[model samples]
Target: MRLTHTGPAPARRDDWQTLKNLWPYIWAYRGRVLLAFACLVIAKIANVLTPVYLKDLVDGLGVPVAVLAVPVAALVGYGLARLTTGIFGELRDALFARVTQGAIQQVASQLFQHLLALSLRFHMGRRTGGLSRDIERGTKGIGFLLNFTVFNVLPTLLEIAMVTGILLWRYDWVFAGLTLGTIVAYVLFTLLVTERRMVYRRTMNTLDSQANGKAVDALLNYETVKYFGNESYESQRYDHDMRSWVDSAVRNQVSLNLLNMGQGLIITVGMTALLWQSARGVTQGVMTVGDVVLVSAYLTQLYAPLNFLGFVYREIKHALADMERMFDLMANHQEIADRPDALALQAKTASLSFEAVDFSYQADRQILHRVSFTVPAGGSLAVVGASGAGKSTLSRLLFRFYDPTGGAVRVNGRDIRDYTQDSLRAHIGIVPQDTVLFNDTIGYNIAYGRPAATQEEIQAAARAAHIHDFVTSLPQGYDTPVGERGLKLSGGEKQRVAIARALLKSPPIMVFDEATSALDTRTERAIQEQLDRIAQGRTTLIIAHRLSTIVQADHILVLDAGRVVEQGTHADLLALGNRYARMWQLQQSGEDK
Candidate 1:
């Protein structure tokens, strides 16, 4: 199958705004953040003083051997300064780790819940692999972003300021001026080159997600691929996606190398100019030999982090890019939301009604029109229809999956729209025609209906659906694994499991949409007896293709194309010799053979 494109492109975001959005989660642990910053500042202070101490130590030793006397105090001061810098740096990281990890946990949790809250329309167009990849990259980026941008940025800037002040105060204007100019040029180069490089990063991300989505889609439909013998076709498509990704990633890396080289060139020119000027001063007797050593020491200390600074800036941009996608997911509007004044549904008797209902998935393709029906409290109604007769649409409307465009659906007595969706759904249980289960044990799938249910209760529901014997015959009994989406089980077995799950729920309102379609005639009859018994004293709605299954319904309605064509009991419809009668005759003729 031709896979659909990944969901909508990530929305554009400003770096400052993205950081602002991320701030609240990190700031939740404000005390830890403050302590981390204190450590960061102390480390920078010690780091800057190291070069100062080294210059003094060198100057003190530049004398006759007897007079120099080892300069033991200067040596000890220098070593202590270096040690302080390292100790505080480690302390800073230790204090800040909790903040970084906590923020990541919060943002990831909120995004996951937001994705779930989005409407069915949004999910229908989403690619699972691509979405998961976005979430993965985004969460991992949080740590790098917090550690690099927050920790390094402040201390690096502070060091630059301190070095600039010292150069201007203790030396000629040329020294400080040259250092500032070189840094300016370096920063401008990094920003411009990085902006250009962002295109490659974004393209690589898109291609990677696409490649992943295609592979996952192919694997999920592994049986379909084998049946059509299209393994090579699938492989070729995946390779095409990967080829694009590889090219984009290569471009990104090459650009990064070029950026680094440019940065290195600028730093080299600045440091050489200052060193040459200092040496010239020493030779001319304008500055002492010890002064030359001092200048060299200071320049060495400053230039190291400047090179790393460019790299940090580049990584920050990449991290922001990753984060923007996850925030974009969080930005998606929840299409289906309950009104603030909506009340919980009070489903006492579970009477259900559709009053002159009309609906369509899209405006141009109407699925139902002006159709109306009702099932009284403790009564059962069965709907019969040809394909595309909008029978399943009825159940969806009752569940409020998509609210009817015209008229209303009432549960008990109030309009369903006036009740919270959760409360409304809690009172209704359905055994869907296509049931998809969790990748878990058989007993676990049944218990999902009511999570707090006892093991004995689960077994009782399993037996009622006539699947307990089969489950027990397995080596693991109820613990038998269902695999992904219950793929290991036969279609009838999956259907029975669904039935047991719904039975376990024991909701006041029940909906069976083509519930027995997967079973043979004999098995269908056996399961039907249990269904009929369980549906007693409860409102039930059945949508069926087989005529024999609904013979016991209190009322049966024949639907053709979106309208009701006949309404009566089985005997009443047969006597009329109309649409329902014709449908009954056709199904009976086929079954006899």
Candidate 2:
């Protein structure tokens, strides 16, 4: 199978469109947002008024010493203005906290559900580590965008406007013009530099994801690397990716420093020009010392947001890039989806049929071709074949993991596609050749077959699978922790756990795909006996590699190269002295030796 290319490309810098898409989530808490905006406005007003109080206090100091009350009042008012500004800013953050947190939760939850709803093919092609990292970065991007764009970016612009208006009115047009020109230049420079830095940022992000994917893949296949004695090989591979990440990170930092230096140069030039003009006016007696101080105070206030704008600009670009990746993931369409009008499966007898079916994972190769078979209600069918003869494909087809390319799979005389996938699978139970359990307790793994099963029911199923005695012998018994993929248990023990799980499901139809292949000879015989007892009145399909295991099957099929070459009872096939007879003779001879 081809690996999917799920990584994002360099996205279009259309931040407004992305924000528009996020409007529904933001709109959900519109009331709180409006209140926050009100608080923001109050805070800015207080901030703007603070400088006016400063101007008054400076002017009041020039008054006669006998009248000290004027200067004292101005000082008090200035302090009150600063305190009000801080209070209102804090209130604004408090009011909007719910909206920001709610949006994060809603977006993360939706992305998780969307990933689950995606088709199995999509999952097969994805790298788990990279996918998870994208999700983490995406959620963090949401928080950054909401907080910075709303609070920092918007408030900065508002404060700039208030400062400009005050300068234009209280001072001359020159002061306002200089302030406005400086702001325009700073904005333009920041945007241009930030756009250039985006390339480095994207490279850094890609390298980071590659390193993470490498680490996770290596760890997950730890046993495989050890078996091959390739521990050093794996380490070198991981280090290669990390080295690339380090290089990209250094380049990213270098570009950022250059951008900061350029920004500082522009701010210094603007500040010097403004201060020189204000000093000239004071010397010419056109403006008092108080006016000069006020203009300087205004410049200081304006510089704060101007510097913040640089940080905000960079963060916004990064956030947008991260969000673009998440949105790309969301854009993946499900290859298999339920029809709008699909109904639940109503399997009264659990009969199964594969009629003239054809299938392939890729167009170049077909795995099943015109294969047909049936299991009548309460009847058993055994299919024996060599590897790649399409035995396991039948089980996957029955489970609806992939729809047949041609013809149909039916259950109870109705097309399985006519029913919802969930309901259709609910009627079938399977015990596969390989079993992988969670890194949880033994009881948790068994109870997974039926989440709501009672303790008694779980023990009964364990007894039916002949594993209850083994479990009880342990000190922890059912509560014993099963290590990753149940590696702590022997192969035979894991197989027993799988059997118990299938028994607990207790569906009307059962498929055993080499279920006893992992067990020892003695354990296989015991499990085979239990399996025979369980299949008495169930619709059973057994795919087997060992010919001796199915000698008592109600019907036997011998498949070669995806075709059913022989079909008969064990005695009749042996009497015919054909393929089945040859296979059985060979197996019995090998066992006797």
Candidate 3:
């Protein structure tokens, strides 16, 4: 496996385009969105009118002692306006909750389904922990974007417009100009500083994903780590990744402090100048005490939303970055898509053939060369070869995991590629050399072969593979939990479970690829008897490394270096004194010793 230091490339996307892509999900709840918008408008109107009520109350206070009753009315109106503002804001949030949740659900479901539909080759190259983290962060980002953009950003802009209009109409253009200038300066500073900080944030995100990936990968290979006594080494590797994350996090925090200090400085200077102007007007008799109070109240209200605007802008950028990763994952194309005209496989006699097949995982190195073979209907063929002789490659080719580089693999005289991959695979059953079970109950794993299998059928299959009695003896019987990859079970037991699963499938064509390699001699003999019974009247292909195992096979092919060195019945090949005879003699000699 190739280990690379860098993470997946950052996605390049226009923020508006990404938002446009998300519009469909949001548009589905247009009615709720409209209701939420109406609530927001009502809330902003109440908020804007509250300051007017406060100005009236201050003017009432300046009246004689007999006019205190008028001040009482103004104070009551001010309190009611504030209460209305809060009520409408909460109502808006309630109205939009469904839209936010529905959009998140829809996007997450589509992304998950698309990921599953991707080809196995894509999965082989993916880091599971990192991919899962991206999905999680992306979904959360969607919620933030939907909530803040509609509720916070839009409302803040609306309030700013109302305040600026009020200031311009009631006073001179100087007050409105200063307000606009301060806001523009604050926003520019936030945008420029946030752009600089994004590099640190992205680096932090990448390191976090890498750390999680390393932890999960190590845990998944817990047995290997223990066997190799590499626990300390794994810990050190994880710590090394965490150290990088810490460094990035420190830089991100430092930049955030700089942004906050700059924002505070701008707000402080703007508030001081506006208050100074209002005081001068009052002293020069150009404005009443009430006008001064109104201006001060407006400035206070404006600053609240201004500070919140800065927060909204920063969060919006972060949400876009998170969403970019999710879109990248969705953008990956399917490598092995079925043709539009592909048809379901039609199996009559279940005969299979490899017609002058050649294959290679990479172009630089070849594995199979001009190899041809046939398994007639209701007949068996056994292939014997040493390691790296391409025995396993035959199984992968027959299963259509990868197409042959040249020539074709056929079922029932038709090229396998002509059939839909799902339909073709449904007719073939395989018991692979390594059996990895799901982390579920034993019965669940067996039932996976035929999801609708009855209890009697599942038990019958287990009995055929000679594992039913052992399962029954356990306290939980079939319900016993199989730990990760079935590590709780011994090698021979896992193989029996795999055999039971294949037997339950009962497909027309079966491939036993080193199916009994994990069993002891006695268990292997017993299981071979069951395999022989099942192979009757079914087309079967066996790939094995043990020479003694195929002595009773109807026909045997001996392979060496991707070439067919000998072929015939086992006894006939022994009589020829070729590669098969030499392998049989050496195995028998080793067994005797």
List, in order, the clash count of every candidate structure: 0, 0, 0
TM-score of each: 0.94, 0.92, 0.89
List the candidate 3 regions with Cα displacement exceeding 4 Å. Answer: 1-21, 60-84, 284-290, 346-349, 551-555, 591-593
* lDDT of all predictions: 0.87, 0.86, 0.87
Put down candidate 3 lDDT per residue, 490-546, tens digits, no spaces. 999999999999999988888999999999999999999999888888889999988
Could you report the Cα RMSD, in angstroms, for every candidate shown?
2.6, 3.1, 3.3
Write down the worst ten-residue block by lDDT for model 3: 1-10
The Cα RMSD of model 3 versus the native structure comes to 3.3
Q: Give the range where candidate 2 is weakest over 10 consecutive residues by summed lDDT.
A: 1-10
Candidate 2's TM-score reads: 0.92
Using TM-score as the measure, which candidate wins? 1
Name the runs in model 1 displaced over 4 angstroms. 1-12, 63-70, 286-291, 346-348, 591-593
Candidate 1 per-residue lDDT, tens place, 258-321, comes to 9888998999998899999998888888777667776787778777777888888888888999
